[model samples]
Target: MLGNVADVAQKEAVAALQKALQSGDVEGAGKAWQQVINSISDKVKTDCEMYNTNQKVLAQRGYRMLTTEETEFYQKLVKAEKESNARQAFTDLITTNGGMPETIIEDVYRELTEEHPLLNKITFQNVKYLTRWILNDHTKQSAAWGNINDEIKQQITSGFKEIEVTLYKLSAYAVIPQDMLDLGPTYLDNYIRTILKEALYVALEKAIICGSGKNEPIGLNRDIHEGVDFNSSTGYPEKTPIKVTSFMPKEYGPVVAKLATTESGRLRTFDEVLLICNQIDYLTKIMPATTVMTAAGTYAKDLFPFPTEVVRSNEVKTGQAILCLPEEYFMGIGGNKDGNIEKDDSTKFIEDARVYKIKMHGNGRPWDNTVAIVLDISALDPAYFVVRNDADVLTA
Candidate 1:
């Protein structure tokens, strides 16, 4: 993986630079710099190719792909991060606060259960496993060192509350809707909101399980977070419980959804969603929403093999069409730092053409009733109250 490769390269680069600076090898250092730059360029090209290949694999596997809005927002995020020094800030916080990730995990769970019953059902035992699951180390069967020491748990828990707002703000970068992060001040509240975002996402997946009609007889029920669930009673006879099968390295779920928004009015059409999934590039004249939705529609007809009900009708107003895309899609992902894509290269590689689109929906009813996408532009633009006062969640 690129992350692992980058870690190794970073170590070598630092060592070489340190040596050059110490030895005063001006000429040798210059050559080293060129070598490193070439290596980086090659890596970047390979990374792009890998990304493209992943897209092809997704297509072959019949999975939904990121929308154009998602692709663009992610690109913008990467670009913006390159311009900032916040990466170290985040790293320092995580490291200084007791490097054990469990502290955050426990506190996150505590806040979730206390405020949200749906999450309250999630016990500590299962949560430890879930953490491991996220780490992609499912083989960790036991939370060894069995007893949950109160002191350790408390310290870890403390870290969770302290970073709640930071986590929430960070999640804004994950492309989650800003409305969801509106819990009032206080570490507990912030923590609660952060937990709610993930819990609700799980809720959504549960809905998909019910909607897929695969788990049990699809049934309707109220989820803990107040989301309606389509469970066994609703219809499917053989669907597995909806759960996150994989933890995205960083939150990309919501940001992927935002990629469909475009224009001043920020309108999106069904076709645009489809075009984005297919990776078809078109002139700027082509509305992104139209391109994406059109492609998705065609793909759905041939690829959607299961029984699922997605409302599709031309009679729906443009506003309604725009509304069809999940609100979560408008949220942005954060805490992403490029791990040096082009570290070294002697061969040419593919470069991806990415597009980003932001659409603001002003409820126009109340001045504050506006929906904005905060892709990767953390540097605030205060002229517009909506733009200025908004959280540093989405940019592009």
Candidate 2:
């Protein structure tokens, strides 16, 4: 799948350049040519910088250098492994420390954002045990604020309420070969990160979109309020999809108006927005609908009436799409809890390897129901670039 291809932007631009050159539109071909050059330049610069980042170095010290106290903490861990069986000693250290160290949690988060485009766009926090904050109840509003009366004072407090964000047990497990564990903290650290991030990239992406709130994060596509459309199989809430036939600006403006405000009808800054769809839908539905030729004549990918950025998540079903401000989604997956790793009794492992279960505490959801809009885009119009017979100008 092109969605799974590496160096995506560069590859896509190169493809577009080839298509543009074939179209015989000199102006569009030139723009596509420029885009190809730019994409390659950026890709090389990014790839070069990443080459210097050694996983072993990061696994030992951390992405952000460990604090003196934390460094000493590891030094003591090294001291604790005086026994010949370093693997057993390390296991004991993990048990004593809750589960995995906070460093691994932080590392996995960094990897998630770096590797996953969906994660990179949203608001993520490494919150503590419990982080309580105030969320204004957009359903309620204060009375007239000009006069300070008893009614006004009483009404003021109704507009907001406090919510406590706490962690829940999101369980996962990883298997490491005995040799790797014997290599001590560095190898274990790297393996733990690999398994954790791979697990989370799929799990979190699915949960953030359609997860039922039963022992998991409430999804952005699900209703925030209680007693909504419930799916018994998965315990997921189903949002009513807005029906739309085309994404052209003339037809697009009003369909997205509902998304340009707070639940309380307050206006929002719309510099950029996120659009998510499954890989199949993106290639067949969204790309045809959103890709438009520019004044320069080169085709643009995923351009919408409002500025948009596209991120693919197979979690989103085919024929459906999600629109929202990326920053409006809130997610926090903190390992700074009473965490621990234990043997998976259910798994019968061979003598060469051992599988361990790791429990992490984390929570995530949209800021509110209004932030995300699910759309029925099965009938979306395909874009076409046409030159007017009378006017010399081209249009998409």
Candidate topping lDDT: 2
Worst 10 residues of 1 by lDDT: 360-369
Q: Stretches of candidate 2 above 4 Å error?
A: 1-91, 97-99, 131-133, 138-159, 164-166, 182-185, 226-236, 294-297, 334-337, 344-351, 387-396
Model 1: residue 28 alpha-carbon error in angstroms: 55
Candidate 1, residues 98-136: lDDT per residue as tens digits?
Answer: 222233334444544464332232222221111111211
Report the lDDT of model 1 for residue 354.
17
Error of 1 at 204 (Å): 6.9
**Model-by-model lDDT, in order?**
0.27, 0.65
Which window of 10 residues has the lowest lDDT sum in candidate 2?
43-52
Give Cα distance to truth, residue 395, candidate 2, Å. 17
